[model samples]
Target chain A: MKYTEEHEWLRVEGDLVVVGITEHAAEQLGDVVFVELPELETQVAKGDEVCVIESVKAASDILAPCDGEIVAVNDALSDAPGMVNDDPQGDAWFFKMKLDDMSVLDDFMSEDEYKAFIG
Target chain B: MAEGGQNGDLQRTVLHDLHLDLGAKMVPFAGYAMPVQYKPGVMAEHLHTRAQAGLFDVSHMGQVILRGEAAAAALERLVPVDLQGLAEGRQRYAMFTDERGGILDDLMVANRGDHLFLVVNAACKEADIAHMRAHMDGVTVTPVTDRALIALQGPLAEAALAALVPGVAAMRFMDVATYDWDGAALWVSRSGYTGEDGFEISVPEPCAGAFARALLARPEVAPIGLGARDSLRLEAGLCLYGNDITRDTTPVEAALGWAIQKVRRRGGAREGGFPGADVILRQLETGPERRRVGLRPEGRAPMRAGTQLFADDTADTPVGTVTSGAYGPSIEAPMSMGYLPAALSATGTQVFGELRGKRHPARVVDLPFRPAGYRK
Candidate 1:
């Protein structure tokens, strides 16, 4: 699993990067209750903020880690928001994108690097 | 009740491991390591539950079962509700009181044939038991501290639950019954704090993990932390026990006097007892000195609780304090509720909320800034 300093992950399948929050971030945010996915075709630059997520206590914006056109969003979040909490690195993919530039991948930490950064 | 073992005064629930597995953001809530938010964040959690379903693990709350022939009579002495009239399988929201009518705690009393089940708030559970135990002679108050509570709330709650229990869909609001789920004796109740259609399931603490896992396994089920729970209830215009209603605030002033059934007021079936009956009855008769009302800010800036409210008619002088306020996701406007002097608490009455060293235009309106979708 690939990771970011922001505690997000992108499971890469060749060129398509599926993104979601990391377990550490999920642990701090608490229960995954609600989610909002941005529209498809929305342009998002790496480091650009898009989408939004909420728990019972606070609201936060889901930042876009990689620049790409929004290709897909987890629509199931509307019904099962806890997916983001229970499986932050797995089923809770916020949006999928074809990275704006492959080099933006260099800015993110690998799973090993992420563990050290969090500590 | 194995309610023993405190992690050096840092209380941890039995399902702490389960919460960690789910990546819950654990924090100190009512003395337990509880989730405040999840990966989806608080705002999204709030809105999603309003539109869909959200599950909350509130097992930290205290549960008690009162046993005795005079159990209802003992309860009536402590609370204002007509306990004798409450049939089995039904619940009544009532408040424990002192001789002087001070609210000790708010609770839900459920009649389970021979026994009365009481659900008390987490922070005040110990005090409730102590007070109840001291007052009763024959009544035996057994704390069901070994139980875990899970609430599945929202419009889809009934459907999701019906998939587990075939008869649950037929249960209306405030009803309760046992459900068959994975060998766990789940006491399912059509009740929730979010003011939405939902169910509160009580299970044996030992089986809580399995039950939670089963619910989490469903594609539609998601774990909702405390953050979303607060926002959802706030949007629904439901008051938080401590933040909104306290010992100092009366039901009438908090706009909760309607919950007091009229039959109990005139000493009909259960009467002339319970603390605060005099002051509570007076409020019902003469109306309240101050009434809880909703405030709508003219600007997008959020006005929070404790923010002073000013009446324009009084040259913008302060008249109230915001008890609870938030940017209502459903209403799409900054909404607040507080106790305002009765005369100025009318609909369309213009007012202002002091926000960040500046006064913002506001108006009092009929509460519930957003339409509540409670399953009737």
Candidate 2:
């Protein structure tokens, strides 16, 4: 699992980023409901929030993990909001950006580090 | 639920581990450990679900079972709804009335035959139980504190839940069912607080984990905390008991006269025992001094609860106070709900709210700033 201090997680593929809310964060939220992902092709900078997710009682912004232009947004969220709550690591992913700074991963937590950091 | 470490901490919920791992901002609510907001903040969370679907953990709410043949009659005496007319597998919104005619609390009354299932507000759970016990003599009232309640609401709720609970599309609004899935028994209701198509599920606390996992596995769901729940409910034009209706306000005055079925008005058999009946019924016929209405703030400024409202057509004398208001997400504007003089409660009435001693123009609108998604 890839991580950010904001508790977002990403599963990186060859050159694409698969993003979703972290398990620790999803549990904290109690139940996931609504997610507003940025539109595809939107330009984003590292550390800038790109989308928002709302639960029954609260709303939160999902930050862009790396500087780049968004390539694909998870539109599925519009029709299936519980996706975030039900599959925070999978379909709940917000959007994927073409990494503007590939080295930015160095600032994010690795699976092991994220686990320890949470503890 | 937070586990007590000799610090009076309560036990945590099934999702507690995930919440802490996600760096959730935790807070205390209704005697349990829960999240108030996450990193993205409360305002945004509140907005997102209005425009989308929001999930909520209202497990803190009190669920109770009233058993025995006396249950229906006993419950009817406590509330104003026509319990005898409520069909099985249906839920109705009601209030516990004081003979003096004030609302003790608002509750969801579900008739399951031989039992009346009630899901009450978390803050008033203790008082509700005490009030029920104080009034009833023979019925058994058991608080099902071990149940977890989850609400999934929004326009998209249908598609998200359809695949999981097949044929739920056939479930009409306000319908309830006993769901058997993944080895757990879930009391599922096609009902929710948010003014949207949705579902509220009650599962055994320990079994909540499995049910939640299955629901989350579906793509449309997300974990929404308490912060969004308030905003969504406000946008939906629903009332939060302490903030809107209280012992001081009669049902008729609060625009809840419709909730009191005509059968219990005094002529019905076994009538008038509930508190505040005479005053409420009289107000029902004569009208209240003040009634609740929606306010559309003219500008971007969001008026908060307790803010005073004045007649925009007149001098600065106050006419009402905001009870619940917010910057609506779906409408993309600032709006509020509050009580105003019944004579001036008509829609299109010119009104203004006070901010920093200055007044801003407002318009009186119907309650439910947003349209209701009742399963009709």
Candidate 3:
């Protein structure tokens, strides 16, 4: 698993990578009320806003961490957005993407580095 | 993002440490480090208030005492409310209007027998106090800095409070009374911003922490924060001081004509003595060009404040802008309140709100998406 400064976490599973916000980001957002995900097969560049998460207080953009083509978007989040707050890294994974460049993943922070960065 | 104090030095409320102790997410609000939400988060807190009771630390709000032989008369000159006939132990919602008929601030004025107790927004308190001091004569405005305010709101508020203070259950909506709690005198009022049956209690600063703890100990009571407070008030269709109403907005334009009782209207006995009376009374006689109305967007994406509104999806000219908006938990949809031309302000009028640079269909609906649960 790797973390981005924007607080999203990515985990490699076979040829696809699952994306979701970190626990710290979920806690900061308070409660997730709505989630707008990107369409399947849409190509996204690193740092592009691929999704939006709306909480009771405000709306925040979820940016892409690595250039990839969207493979599967989380359909479950459409009915239960609070899953992001309840299990941010697991079932709450926003989407799965087919990585176009594995080299881009090296730029992300390790778990320890991410913890230090937030602190 | 929260706005810190002007000079970078954030002020702390009396319940600052208590909030931290409860793992509250503290953020700067109105120059104070206030809790935006606790561990349960804003959504839960909002639902809790609607179902049960929630305690809010509103100590940042300004409390003042206006005292003089002609205090009521002096107050009438600044606000449009008819205070001369306001009986003791009653409260009224009022605003300070400028010479041009714009709202400077909206406040609550409670007649406490010998003096009038005024509660103003934290951000506008300094200017409100100075404005009152400069304009009024024969009255002394004293800021009550040693007191902290706590709001106990929801269906269970009366029962929760009655357990702590015996006579609180009998107080009707808008009733104000003084009660003794733990040897401290508490000024309790059956009024709140959530459109619920609630009480706002003003306790001495030193006792605020203990008082809040005692209330939280009740089975129905939970500690809420500013985030829930804003959402609750928005769901209730209440105006937030700087957001919904501002120096550029007027009561008439904000759909607050009911607050300007008939006693202060053009044909009233006390016709037009307050500041901006000419313009305000004129608007009262003939409606304002634009009025505030509730907006219900058609999708799940929340249309937030600052979102522009157009008459139609293809219209080039924007008709209005959203002032306060959020996904209302009680209403179970994305709701907002914004200003629109009087013709387009009618309920069921089709409109479009520009979100993420695209116009989305919406409708102008009657305010207060959720029914008020006040114990009237």
Question: For all the predictions, what are the DockQ values?
Answer: 0.12, 0.06, 0.67
| Best candidate (score: lDDT) | 3
Writing each residue's lDDT as its tens digit, candidate 1 over A37-85 gives: 7888888876776766654334566788876888888898866776887
| Candidate 1, B1-376: lDDT as tens digits | 0122444566777778888888777777788878876777666677767777788899999999999999998888888777888888888888886765556788899888889999999999999999999988899999997889989888887777777767889887888788777777888888987767889989898998887777676666778888668767776777877777888888778888776776668655654477888888788789988988888877555567888988763464688898887666667666788889999888998888875456878888886666666556
TM-score of each: 0.75, 0.73, 0.96
Tens-digit per-residue lDDT, B1-376, candidate 3: 2332353488998998999899987788888889888988888999999999999999999999999999998999999998988889999899999988889999999999999999999999999999999988889999999999999999999999999899998888888999999999999999998988999999999999999999999999999988889889998999998888987888999999899989899889987798889988998889999999999999787888999999988889999999999988888888999999999999999999998787889899997888898878
Lowest summed lDDT across 10 adjacent residues in model 1 chain B is found at B1-10
Winner on lDDT between 1 and 2 is: 1
Error of 2 at B243 (Å): 0.2
**CAPRI verdict (incorrect, acceptable, medium, high) for model 3:** medium
Best by TM-score: 3
List runs of model 1 lying over 4 Å from the truth: A1-119, B1-9, B267-269, B313-317
Error of 3 at B102 (Å): 0.7
Q: List the global CA lDDT of all models.
A: 0.78, 0.77, 0.91
Q: Candidate 1, after superposition: displacement of residue B73 in Å? A: 1.7
